[model samples]
Target: MEENAIRNKYQELGVEGFYTQYGADYSNPHEAQIRQLLLQNQDRIDYNKVLDFCCGSGEVSRTLIEAGYGHVFASDPFTYEAYQKNCGRECWQYTFEDVIRTPIPEQFSAVICSFAMHLCPDEQLFPLVYQLFQSTSQLVIITPHKRPELEQLEGVQLAFEDFCLTAKGKQVRLKAYTSTFTY
Candidate 1:
């Protein structure tokens, strides 16, 4: 799906329904690996204001809060009210395009996005990455390390050391990589 198309589809997804469908807490193999990577780099992340870009169901933001992050803003194209209600934090139903159109209210000390970047093609993803780099002091991107992933939402279901394929096609292996930078 194209960026504009994805934006439109998610915009119609109401908060209550979004969670019932794609809530973050759902058992995903990659979840533990992602958490470990974040934990290992705790010193690098800012414990202050954080933004979970494309925070599907607020699971990462919720985890960060529990890990002592002061405040977290969970934003996604689909507004999952269940996450806000159950996670006890603010949730914004904003598309990635919206974030680009309008700057975030407060600068984020640490920005985390998981299983979201792959939704855009490289043409958009690289620029989007640059944009993310500008919005926050630190950034964490968790996506499958494959070309196709740059344009689709299909993520690898991680197991121990490898990410299993979620979509049917030439199976691609995901090697978790955590690239961090401080500005």
Candidate 2:
């Protein structure tokens, strides 16, 4: 799909609605940048166990797996088929709201939310992040825009951050945060 069309669709339907309507067919146009960001930050990420939160088409999981990180898990309210087909793994059907309601059962070394954290509504971000921190000490968010600054929230501290630029010179950032809350 052309970039403009995708952007227009997203703008038309809004994030949640766009994903709800076209998630199975969804694909990240910035795969190259995402791959670069993950590869460059591999040393920083804990590979013990990682959750590919909002794992759209398993882009993050695919990159990490190809790099020999075998302990990646995934969850998305939408894109289950694409994720399973691409990553050859089952994806938990959990939305931000779901996580806030009931935290993930398993603990993770790090939870990576690529290209999706910004979609979370402002009102729910804190509760969702609080619940996520209960499941993982580290939360890694990769986004094209700088919204949803996790560090602004209490109990979340920025540990490290890096970025890769697209061909158009847009920045795609990978920011890792550690929970200050005692788990």
Candidate 3:
């Protein structure tokens, strides 16, 4: 979906029910892998405010908050209320067009986005990456599909696979990457 079309749709239709669709604790599956990756790179991340960009339903944010991490935020075009009720942290809901129109919030210690990067429009990908880089020095991106383009960026320091558990007791392989780019 194009940026404007999604924004228009959300404006007219309102945010959809989340629990009935994506469930509440949907972030658990990726927890172990995320923890492992963080632990492996603890020396780099400054443990400052973390933003889970494209955090659908705020599962990741809720998990982090529950784990006692402070200063965490989430952002997505929809799922604002779900994130509020589930994570209890502040979140910004912005469409691609909205992001393009307005500048992303300033600096973050780390920006973690899981399972949603592939949904980004082709034209918006570069800008989104640039935005992320500008907003944070540490970037963690996990996508279910291949995004070789991200590897070509200037300062992606790490790339690995994260096996996220599925509802069916299976594991879904996701491409996990870390971009330690400043600016």
Candidate 4:
């Protein structure tokens, strides 16, 4: 499958291994920091029916739930097992192949794609993005700045970046871009 090819490529590279090696906190940026950023903008966004796309181990979903976001749907092409191991939340709707092949059946309050877009190959990037965009009114992306993967997408806008400083004081920019998607 297409997702498996990407997964295998990630495994060959160090992306998946690094994520698995250091767990959630060491994945360049942690998810809780993004949650704090989203919480600050909570007045504008609905906290219900959120989709955590490319949800590696559901760390971000757990963080969102802790921050009072209800109905968080965690989806990934390869990490739901890890998610079950990590948080074990009872929402039973996603599988490894769901994100790529299965269409998003309905609009969500917001769709959150963190760190995954950069991993997507050029051929798959736009359609995946369009699918995400078509499935939600707002798409929140927390990605590295200067991601060429997103350079040419037609239907999204940059909202604001929350540059998080680690304990070591290193700057990790979570570029939270937004867009209104209507089907």
Candidate 5:
């Protein structure tokens, strides 16, 4: 889809609605930048166990796996088929709301939410993040927008950040955070 068309669709249906309807076909246009950012900072992630939250099409999982991070799990309420097909692994069907209601059962070294965290509504962000922190010490959010700014949350701290630019000069950022609350 064209950029403007995607934007219009998002405006028309809202983020969750749009994704619920089209997530199986969703593809990140900034995938190259996402790959670049992850490959450049792969060392920062713990390969022990990582959850690719909101793993649309398994972009982050695929990148991390290729980088030799063996224990990569993925979850996306809407993109299970795409994620499984792309990454060749089972994708947990957990939505952000689900996580907020019940934290993930397994602990992870880190949870990577790529391209989709910013879409979370403001009211739900804190609880969702708090729940995520319950499952992992590290939370890595990769976004093209600055809305999430997870560091603003009381217990969350931005430990490191880096960015990669697209051909049109848009900045895609990788923000790694840690919270005072331990799992």
Candidate 6:
């Protein structure tokens, strides 16, 4: 992905403005189907202090809240006012660099990132994943499972055990592995 294009798009429209101008109505049937799928698995995942990284419009954040998760944090570098207004919450404006530089406030029970990690350039891969592991007690990364382009990326294939066996030995467990595809 071209970082400049992404940044420029956000700059031109901001998060909410862009979505309003270009986004499809989630009220459509296909989105309803996706929401049903999400709800089906919502019960299986841990949600304590969940962080929705790169949460563009906080759709999944609202889902987590509706599924009964409390203390959820949503973030993106761009201003997602549409999402914030929809969810009745504010978003933290921070880039992945900022996320890595600052200490994560809580050992999150679940960290959710969808279509977010792939945006990090190749050089930022390891460091970003390391920080991701550090921030979350459980990681639920949702990316295109069949993206051959990303097949060799370590972040996509990283085992939960690898992060669990740290010097701190925080006694982490590989709770689950999940993925999806976009049509």
Task: Report the number of the highest-lDDT candidate.
Answer: 2
- 36-146: candidate 5 lDDT, tens digit per residue: 998888678675799999999988888889888889999998889988888889999998889989999999999999988888889999999999999988999999888
CA lDDT scores, all candidates in order:
0.57, 0.90, 0.61, 0.62, 0.89, 0.56
Q: Which stretches of candidate 4 lie over 4 Å from their true place?
A: 1-29, 90-102, 148-151, 176-183
Backbone clashes in model 1, listed as residue pairs: 15-79
Q: Candidate 3's residue-wise lDDT over 1-183, tens digit each? A: 433554475456643433234433334345555554444544555556888887776755655666667788788766666677776767787665666666576678877777566656677876777667777766676543465357665665555544554445544444445666554
TM-score of each: 0.62, 0.95, 0.66, 0.70, 0.95, 0.62
Q: List the residue pairs that clash in candidate 2.
A: none
Can you list the residue pairs that collide in candidate 5? none
As for TM-score, the candidate ahead, 1 or 2, is: 2
lDDT-better candidate, 3 vs 6: 3
The per-residue C-alpha lDDT of model 6 at residue 78 equals 58
Q: List the pairs of residues colliding in candidate 3.
A: none
Residue pairs in candidate 6 whose N, alpha carbon or C atoms collide under 3 angstroms: none
**Cα lDDT tens digits for candidate 6, 1-183:** 243564587689875575455443222112232244445556666777888777766656877778777688987665356557677787877677876786466677677766456567667765665666676645665543222133254544433321122233322222233222211
Tell me model 3's lDDT, rounded to 2 decimals: 0.61
- Model 4 lDDT tens row, 1-183: 233554575678676574454433322235555666566667755658888877777756877778777688876645656766776764344432354466688778888776566766677666676676667766776653356335357766766555565455645455544555455
List, residue by residue over 96-127, the lDDT tens digit for candidate 2: 99999999999999999998888889999999
40: Cα error in model 2, Å: 1.2
> Candidate 1, residues 1-183: lDDT per residue as tens digits?
433443465667743353345555433345555565566656655658878877765657766877877687888655456567667777777666666666566677767777666565456654465456567655556654454332232222211223334334323233232224333
Query: Native-vs-model 1 lDDT?
Result: 0.57
Backbone clash total for model 6 is 0
